[model samples]
Target chain A: MSDALHDPGTGTPGPPATPVLSATGLTVRFGGRPALADVSLDFPRGRIVALIGPSGSGKTTLLRALCRMNELIPAAVTTGSVRFEGAELYAPEVDPAEVRRRIGVVLRESALFPGSIFHNVAFGPRASGFAGDLHALAEEVLAAVGLWAEVGGDLDLPASALSAGQRRRLCIARTLAVRPRVLLLDEPASALDPVAAARIESLIHSLAGDVAVVVATSDLRLAARVSDVTAHLDRGELVECGPTGTVFTNPRSKRTEAYLTGRIP
Target chain B: MTPLATRDLLGTACRLGAALTLTAAIALLGVLLVQALGVVDVGFLAGAPSRFASRAGVGPAIAGTLWLAVLTAALSFPVGIGAAVYFEEYAPRNRLAGLAGSALANMAGVPPVVFGVAGLALFVRGMGLGPTILAAGLTLAMLALPTVLVTSRTALREVPRGVRDAASALGATRWQVIRRQVLPAAGPGIVTGLTLALTRTVGAAAPLLVLGAPAFVTHAPRTPGDILTALPTQAFTWSTRTEADFAALAAGTAVTLLVLLLTVNLGALVLRRRLR
Candidate 1:
């Protein structure tokens, strides 16, 4: 498949190139029940791909599989090749920690640590032994996520003191502080109010030039608004993947059309 | 019966149990206080145990108790916490690990005197440490280890899996995730567990009695090498005497041990708050 999908910003096709990360024939099962089946996709750097499906359609599972995050579940069994920077992720010698560090994920709950804002934002860099000034890096990411102004530049304030939107932004800032090549977000705005969700959408859009972003979301509007390419999944199967406008306006598969038209989940 | 009526009955039963327990505790404390009034002075606290009740003090016993508490904490805390971490974090989900975990859970509930018997055989007869404070400390450490391990594991498990996942997603190694996230998140619970284990070991008389703690020592223990003597054993010895004065001294010794235990519990409470 070509890597060039219409750029969400300009609606112009980008140059085709080798993907920064690619998954081929990926299949994942939890205790003999398949969650994702033979899903193949490519994630090119500096582009955002949104995976849209109904609940239990395996969007979150696909995102976790990309970084081998599914391995954390004891019952999860995966078969397939996921290549990041041309190296097999499931190789016996490959360190999962390194893969995860290079390809970060933000879970739906935000999951900020019960500590100061600075502590939450700086956690990834500190864990990875980043040699740069942590304070400056934390400030930068917080500012990028638009949380620094809301927190009033008080990095030491307890993370729990922040509102729901601010906490989600802090989680994003934490992931960004690690400087990953690929960013996976699962329902980043699903749990927020409209205003907060809009803020998160803009913040995610602002990340397009810096990282290869994959978003797994149930919101079709969000996928169309922020993604260059959109992949539709249903019941552990990939139905269609193409430019966002094409996927929404002229879907090839009947399943995609039905779901898009609110005829079926 | 209706659900509301059942609930009311249960509440009344609980309230009655609490009242009975409170009344019993207060009665016991009142008796001890009345008896310990004149006998528990600074001179009585500092003086050595004597044949005469008026000249007796728990100085050596108090020193021995302190030493035992220190040694028990030093030996058990690290080993127990390490074993707990291994069981929770690193151990594979296999039959052997499951068996070992079950064994630890069972051991936590075993009587302290059982550990003392093992310690007597292992440290005293087998290792030739004798009935010294070292031997008693080692015995208490044995008594505390299982309790510490069980409680620490429980504390570690209480930390949300999300915390571990978040740390792991940041590229943290297993050890780094445990050290930075899991341990800090579980700190207060661990501290409370350690405090409970330490205090239980501190106040235990059965283990020391089983280890043959001497009733009378002329001087405070200069080192762990000295003969083992503690407030529990001292109080037990004094309480066994027919003299009324000796009974008063025993109550005073018990009162002193209670105060020391309260101090330890208060310190642990403050530490837990800070950690949280």
Candidate 2:
């Protein structure tokens, strides 16, 4: 357990030392119903922030808004501002594709393309017009996710043949192959077994120093175990946010405390 | 009866129904094969049509049909696939898009003769393409375009939304996602649809007839502009003739057309299986 990124004391999070991405009063509505309402947060570089909420807590919606993926839904309307590094994400001149490349997202379904495992990982780089050696890059990322030894020899095999956990790892590897600066994972391990989930948690922990990570999960124990910072959302609103230890042990909001203790309906 | 017995009885009934349909199709094919066996010789395929039925052949018609099939496929497949990609991926989810979708669906069910009439007015007279293979090819392409578009749209829709979102999240532009992910995922279905459209166009004579495809041509078409006669037209012409041998030649031409359709369909089947 590396405590290098975790703050020592339990307290509300002050202004981040180096904010990689920040949302100020971001609100999203679908068909006139709010999915995320007046939510504001900062994701600092080299840290993992866990978003914990029950279903329909706007966790997924916030992640999608960060990457501008919410635009894919025709009825989704987003307001307020999202800034990555220093630039407005929804600026007229900003390309959503470029934003996605910089801030990669791993969806809950772990959608792997219908091709070889190598091709699945290589697809991102190739689509972004990567000019360097593709094979070496793919190998490097696959190894990073600890999939090289098992799938290296048979990179040509269809990705659909892999088990659920392997497929999830492959999705992460594919995102990493593009060398994204920020990674947003929506329940990356919720569907996996305990062992696999732990492996994913550790992998995410190890990745914090190189890339900022925001993980949205329903599992509070997983959040408590892995996150340096935790933000609790309820009914499309931010309920409480602070250092993980403080938020878990002494949440200021009754809603957050009830939800954490399984009292909320 | 027990619930399990009732379930088994329903399943057996469905199986029997399917078997009966297959049996009927095989029986029809057998009859056609028997009728076509004796008259469909090398000369019947190689020689040109003549007043004397035994001397007549389908070489020119076969060449014309091939030209029409190739040209129509070259024109329709890409355009139809492009339209389908637009509708499935890029089109806005608005009332206009909805209206266009319904219009496209209705177009798929429009009579082939209606397309033929439109092609006659549009390409033959309006464009001044004249009654040449080019004109007929364009006409048949129009006839098959709706089916290609509709089937291609369905195929593109069949690609998982998750696969599309994954590609987009990896920074692929809309075109890149469609080209690299959606298109390849839907390849087998698109190929199957295109093959089926080509088969239908190849068998159809009404469109070409509307475009004034000649019933008899002695020489094979050497270029798109050359006047042409297709297999179905030749078969139709011969079947209407008074000579008994001409009727035999008609069956032979039908057999030749059937063989060409089967070869294409079988090739598509093999391709689809390989893709899967």
Stretches of candidate 2 exceeding 4 Å from the true structure? A1-16, B1-20, B273-276
Mind giving the per-residue lDDT tens digits that candidate 1 earns over B103-218? Answer: 98898899988988998899888999888999999999988999999999999999998889888888888899899999999999999999999999889998888888877787
lDDT of 1 by residue, A69-142 (tens): 89988789999999876678888777788888888999875577889988887888887789899989988999
Candidate lDDT values, in order:
0.90, 0.89
- TM-score of every model versus the real structure: 0.95, 0.93
Clashing pairs in 2: none
Candidate 1 chain A, poorest ten consecutive residues by summed lDDT: A1-10
- What tier of docking accuracy does candidate 1 attain? medium
Candidate number of the best lDDT = 1
User: By summed lDDT, which 10 consecutive residues of candidate 2 chain A come out lowest?
Assistant: A1-10
